[model samples]
Target: MADSTGKTDKDVAPQIQATDVQVEKRASDDESAEKGVFEHINLNKNISARIKNPLADLSPAQVLRDVEEFANEHGLVDVLPALKKGALVARDPDHYESVPDMTPEDLTTIDDEVTHKWRQPRRLYFTIILCSIGAAVQGWDQTGSNGANLSFPDALGIPEKDNPNAARNQWLVGVVNAGPYIASACLGCWLSDPVNNYFGRRGAIFGSAVFCFIAPIGSAVCQTWPQLFITRLLLGLGMGLKGSTIPIFCAENTPAAIRGGLVMSWQLWTAFGIFLGFCANLAVKDTGDISWRLQLGSAFIPAVPLLIGVYFCPESPRWYIKKQRIKEAFESLRALRNTELQAARDLYYIYSQIKVEREIAGDGNYVTRFIELFTIPRVRRATLASGTVMLAQQMCGINIVAFYSSTIFEKANATVTEALFASWGFGLVNFLFAFPAIFTIDTYGRRALLIFTFPQMAWTLLAAGFCFYIPTESRAHLACVALFVFLFAAFYSPGEGPVPFTYSAEVFPLSHREVGMSWAVATCLGWAAVLSITFPRMLAVMTPTGAFGFYAALNVTALVMIFLWVPETKQRTLEELDYIFAVPTRIHMRYQAFKVFPWWCQKYILRRNVTLEPLYKFDGVQTRGDNRAVKE
Candidate 1:
């Protein structure tokens, strides 16, 4: 493929052979005599007829040269196959810098940025709407059971004061909530890559929808508490799928610019669902027989819409690209953006860049890729951070309120209506506060919010503990506890709630994202199960003062650990962070440089009051180097 220059394909091929770049050129480069090699690569027509301008205005030679050096340095050996020996030389024998034909190597320079966007994209308005709905469904499922517990005591024929099976029933409901998480944590990690590889993102959603429908009906009809318990467990399996798939689906469907906003919407809507469930509790008066059953069965309402709507929702474009379904990816991008083929060309170019990175990482398969996450130090750090956040979120004592607020309020001597209203208030605060994270997460960055929040939560809890310890059983003590609880939700809904999911999505290699998310969820569920099982007894044994104090202590410890360990992950695309972890460096420096700043600010620099545009997009390439280079 030599042209007038001395450049050759081999010179520009990726540092390694990549499996995804096989091109079926509909129109030959020679046929388009006036077009240059890079031009032909960008303009070639397909079924969707997309045309993109590459590193437009920059020399193809420079682009290819940069990509080659970058790949070689990064150990991206799989991309080498994309090159032909004469790609650069074939362009122009007279001009040594020329590139001939679109050597796949030339496209690898943007691999990190391209793949990260596709894998964890900036979501659209409609897609955000759907994910928010999904989050709401999760919230409903979690809180719906809480309301049922009130009417449930009679419906299940159990006595409040002397029921022998009370512990079992509590476990049944709580465990069912936990069951889905367990299955999702295990199965999600185990099967995420395979299911994603074979069925695409749409398939996982469809499967989740089907199971969601089945699980709710099973819960609606179960005659015995154990049967109800079993049904709940089954329900968890389905919800587990939703939990693991939702983030992946949202991340892949979105664009880089709006990635955090889209993903954080999951937490916001989860609060909305909880609030809705609390309202439902207020509406459903407990009749002696069927009150709890009907309330528990209410999950079917949202389940129906999700099942139907998901059938029509688009498959994730990133998943399409990963599967090497180019035309399908273009079609999805076209529908998502509602744009012409020109936009799709750029999308495919982005897809090509991602494909190169995936191949370089040698993660096209599910099994080995997943195992490699734990084996690799950088990925393990991410996995640990994700687990830490999940633990912090659970131990923050918010779930204690969601799951046991009524009990706690009742113990504090509030009337039933007061308790229910208090629960509603809790949900309201969570839902309202969640909205801020959608804006602040990418602006303030994950680390800053956490650094600010956890300490406040710690102080609030300590104050609440003191108020409880005071001799006066004054209304002010209850108010103090209430205030602390609200602050816990407010800080947590934004920082702890959303950041963990965002971190989970971005931290691992794409090949292992599913499993990594699974492991993270599993860790979350493990802690949740421990908390749920022990919470009743812990409260019984230690009383409210001790439990609040213990949780407060956990919060303080978590604040310290996060300050020391949790890396900031605000604006950096998944690709850029992967590379940062791939080598050793000051995590905070990389965090500050790429992950923390607002995107617009990073594009320009303040040099003595004169703004200068950065030469490179900060998507994946590091602006500075550090210690981990020693490993190489």
Candidate 2:
């Protein structure tokens, strides 16, 4: 160093500053790398402000060309003429006369689709009703354990009555109660993708219904607690598979406008089944030693109708389309809808959307689809949103009441008979309140209902927990406990209960739907299993006060998760929601925290006249897939 000069090589270096002109470059590149999940597919750089209507940009000529290309691609030449008119109507329903040779009948059918959206085909109702029956099977069967929890342990030699090993017996009772959920969480839910993939939705439902039928009979005949547990596990297998598929089956068959209302039939009927289970409990309670057996056995009755009726219902047309059974898909859609014109439009539109969805997937097997649920940006958001809602269901603690309401009532000093009656009240309140959701879910939207109801649930549940502290001698104690529990159910049934399944069913793209649903269902039942298995011991240790309080706090946590992550899915079609989920989670959170929340406080709290800026806009930059139509 001394060879160059007295000042060493360090002193000879060029003067440099920490700041640089290139400072802006790398940061942007890093940010882009993170947010580039939907870059090629998205029309707008601000994916938070997503565009709806995938068909919004196509001109009349382009629409015609797209129809021609689609027909040629699918070899649908025989119905090409009908397909053309259908596309024109879908592309612009108001200008149906623009469709060449458009008939008066077409006008009436299209007008009816808007004016009388509920006037669906007979087969569609049969399909929805059948799917609802499957949901009822779970609700009714779960409650069978609720009543049987009183007597089964005694008959099976695992009584939780006062004894040195009563805690152990309590744990055993919890285990037996949890067996169905355990199997469902670990085995049955995981099986959904493969079963649905190989056998279709109906095959999955029918196979599950068989188990739903047999497992109850097996539970009734069990000589030991272990045998009863095994039988319940078998029931869980059926429940997990059916639970994952039924909502999807209902959502796929129903139209967009009333999809929320109709799909929520799953929740409505499940509540009804719970009421029926309580009725069954009371009906058999006077049968002496066989009362628990009868309570457990009666669950199979609901499953019988599901097994018989699923065959009569139309299979989901989306399932048909997924399998490339195009003609069958068209026929199923036609059977589900009132007119061929509507069917053709829906058929072509779903096909177009599926084509785009598949392109995003870029060819994959079941494993790959599951992986893409988190890997693909648009799909990852749906996965997160669905996962949050599903997990929140368990956290909100409805199943605790469903699984142990009678036990909870008894713990609060009500007699066994009084507890059963109280639980029946809870089920009734849950069922009766669910009716408002049918009208409100579509009007108020999924996220809105959840946002409004969660705080009410939190307070009501906490109030129920506090009721545990009231003196046993006071009649008001039991009445107050039951009242608050009923209030909790009243809030839960309409909002959290229906939204999870309905929202999850619609969130994922078709290619990943089965696997996504499998994940969602697994999350729900897995937590339910955990909660059910631990609850008896928890009741002994933490007491009803702490247990209810735990879930009450979770309601608030779940609300924050819903507020930040869940998007508003009101009347948006399945295809349009692809763009909604494409929005980044961070962007959504920022909008909520800074913009939406502020606007709410201003307009609602402060009574200001300020107009709130909307997150989703109708028009924007066009996707590459949509742009191709225009260029062609």
Candidate 3:
């Protein structure tokens, strides 16, 4: 039975399936070696992903020694016992009895963490709530301008309609509305990093609150378009700074399991602010020429609470750790977590992750770190992913309705009063729909919600546009348009509304987080400026049907980009994402197209029972048995 020179047939190797081969090559050092022969070959390949816990295999003695060294180096020798036990527990959260210096009380609280995960400390809730209130300032500003759009033109002697200069006035109106967005995109977002470095998160937030408070009052008093534009731009400075900082502040303070749900309060409170603006608009509709002024000035109301409340909250422990103040970091963590054990565990774990992060990102100046978001392999992937979601938020066209629903209704033959009511309905739907995301975003996950809702939003939006073709004389004309628009708001509130900011906040390594967020926020608000400026013309040229169809197509386009590029980060710690993003873009896209697409077709389309292959191998285990993706 010999085949080769002096070798028996028993020595011959058997053929392996491509799936088996890919699984086998998971440990290979070369990225190209992991590819199946028929798979797309990538010229610009990244290194292999190495996924493991840095402290998992350390013995109790080794854990003690590591803690001792960390404590000694950081001048924390006084709390060595707690540090040792915490280090051990962090290394094995599920297996804590074996950890030394353990108490019965500690065991009970740690056990309760699994059974009662939502029972977080009051200080933790308060911090997230107060910080998230900053988003109200942003939302109120947008809608105050929206409500003002109706009357500001006439007040400034530039009528938006029924005049010889109507076309020019529309563009001018668009420009005036676009001012805040432009200022935020260009200046306010870019200032986030330096501001955070100099003033810390609380200081930056307080400073932004001052601007949010003052700018709205200036907006209320302006007699000319130029003066109002100046005030709006000043509002942008605060909006950009607050918007960029608040989400990160929320993300850092929250537990990974509940992070997305908690952090999405940024969008939730924003919806609330929009609702309040509508109420204000209604309140002043009969006040002659002063209605728009009252609407614009009322935005300062949210800023009032934000300014007074920020200093009362606890600082982010990760921010403290980043500054190398381990003691203060410990104290901050204690306030945020359920127990001292939890605090110590976080302190040690975060410290470990940050050390690895520093090595990955390297020591660099702000400009250098900003460049690394594109240059470094891991960071570049995060940048591209976050940037896509941010850009997609604008492309989804919710802002079209948010900024101009009143005008859109008026154009559809409703009186000005009816239009205000319709805008308020859209705001109500937006705020109410967001509540479901708090329950579903963690369980159903970020990518699932996005994939599920994008198509729904597209069709609903398209339906609303087609309703514009309905006879203007019919009572059902405006009603149909309003119904579809409200439906679109419902679909949008849970998916694209919450995903963009939440996704962008968590993607980057801590080393580049502030700068990366600035980039992501700038991309969002920058495109928002373009949309705001162009939409007046889009309405004039394309009409409502054409604009709706246009953004509907973009919904599909955004879905494709999300499916191909953005990885799900639900329930994942910020540090754990380094491994997830390490898998190159080509590999992720190929798996989605070739593996997942086929499995989806079999399971959902053809009604056949099938198992989809898992993309991620976390903690050296290949997850199986109908577990939804933590996919690349």
Candidate 4:
């Protein structure tokens, strides 16, 4: 400035220096601003590129991570958060815009809101409670038959202690007791898909409730073992339908956040039913002929409530969506969720997933669709996982305890009175331990629970078997066997008992959900049939110790299958699991063990600042196709 105005040389030099400093500062600021602009542009471009071709060279874990980061950068949240901030709203009366494409993370976020909302005492909980009443009937039917075994033989004119036809009588007992499972496996499983597809989840459940009512009444009136067997066979048809449909209903209607617990409530109530059955048996054990009849008839109580209540319950929104009854789906969702925004969000996610599924299915017939379970690698994996878990549940010998606990106690040298009371203890343990799963299942995840508990179950079964080696006259031996049996129940209730049903409910895609569940349930019934038919003979042949050992071996096998095959399904949307299983089997087989420990440590011990990136990656080609049809 001084140079231009013709000032002194010293003044001009100082002015020049100040000008230089200001110019340098301005240039540096310009450079930093340009750098920020470039960095932002790069980040946005990267995200867009990933979205455009999501499956291109990305692992399933990487895809999940990228989608989550994208949601965060865009200021996304789940249903509750969006609703509180007014980011989500119902469509205008005149014109409606389609919902935008959502990642599985976004879908799961919406599910979280619905779940949190349902946790309050609301219509959703009421529906779950009502639907679960059928499960109580199932439990009652199961243990009621076990209690009847105490006296039904004599009532049927079969010998009590020293019959020469003990083998034939044993066969009669097993066939009558397992008649339902046999019917379920052979006929009911085949019918489940068609029934659900034709009648919808609510209709299927209602029909089952009716059959449950009729079957138990028939059993109470039956005069012959053969007549009782036919009634049980009819009951099995009802059970098969309920088993396949109820879990699907609960899963489709409830929020994914609490879906595990709610669907698992089926098992919880089943435990309660077992408790009721034991109490009923205690009340009638001393009665001569009426004891067995009354025990069989008691099943009618829960069925009445189930039949009446399920009629008033909302149908699964997913079923409505599948039928393309979009308006009804929205209404059903609204009834189940807290707000219109939540319902809309859920509908958006569900619709997107259904579209993807239909595209894959391509107007296939029922037989073709059923065959797809095996032909499609991803779905086949799901089928295998579900079936294996069900098989494992049966083979672990929980039913052995459930069906013959009184006999087991007798074998342990307890009197009839003591055995009946001890049976009550077994039922109590089964009921009490199921509560922990209600709390921990969504938090700890399914795989972790299986891993932790399977080993414990194996140990307990083995110990119980070994305890039988001590003389039956030894009170200490009897006590040890009883303690081990109780411990087995404790481990099983929280893990295998509930996980199989819940996990199977979740694994299948909406397209094949009913059929897939049917197959899974069939596997359960098939195994149950084999065990029920053989266990009495097994008891006569192998004795209690050898039978327990066989169960222990099965548990060990189950543990291995779980470690190798099952993935962590916590906090994931049902659609997200498709990608998870799409990961190559070889990669999972190699890295599974190392992946297990860190996941457990992070959730249980680390508590903060834990990274789980390495646990999910492997050196393998990405098998998931570039199916970004939802984005369009």
Clashes of each: 42, 0, 0, 0
lDDT of 1 by residue, 234-351 (tens): 6666666666777877776665545777787778877888888777766764454565666567765666667667656677776765666655665676566523322333343454
lDDT of each: 0.59, 0.82, 0.82, 0.73
Best by TM-score: 3
Candidate 1 or 2, higher lDDT?
Answer: 2
Q: Please, what are the lDDT tens digits per residue for candidate 2 over residues 371-439?
A: 888888778888899999999999898999999999999988888889989988988898999999999
**Deviation in angstroms for 337 in model 3?**
0.3
Where does candidate 3 stray beyond 4 Å? 1-50, 620-632
Predicted candidate 3 versus true structure: per-residue lDDT over 1-632, tens digit per residue: 33212233245223222121122111112334232121111112323434445456444555576688788888878877778888888776656776776899887777666556689999989988888888887777777878888999999988977899988989889888988789999999888999988888898899889999999999999989999999999999999998889899889988887899999999999888888888888888889889999989989998888899998888878888888888888888889899877888778988876764654656689999889889887789989999999998888899998888898998889998999999989989999998899888877888998988899989998999999999999999999999999999999999988988988999888888899999999999999999999898899899999999999999999999999999888887777777678778888899899998899999999999999867876552112112312321
Q: Model 1, poorest ten-residue lDDT window?
A: 42-51
Off by over 4 Å in 1: 1-58, 61-123, 151-160, 163-177, 186-191, 338-342, 345-349, 470-474, 585-632
List the candidate 4 regions with Cα displacement exceeding 4 Å. Answer: 1-121, 593-632
Model 1 quality (TM-score): 0.74
Q: Give the 10-residue window scoring lowest on summed lDDT in candidate 3.
A: 35-44
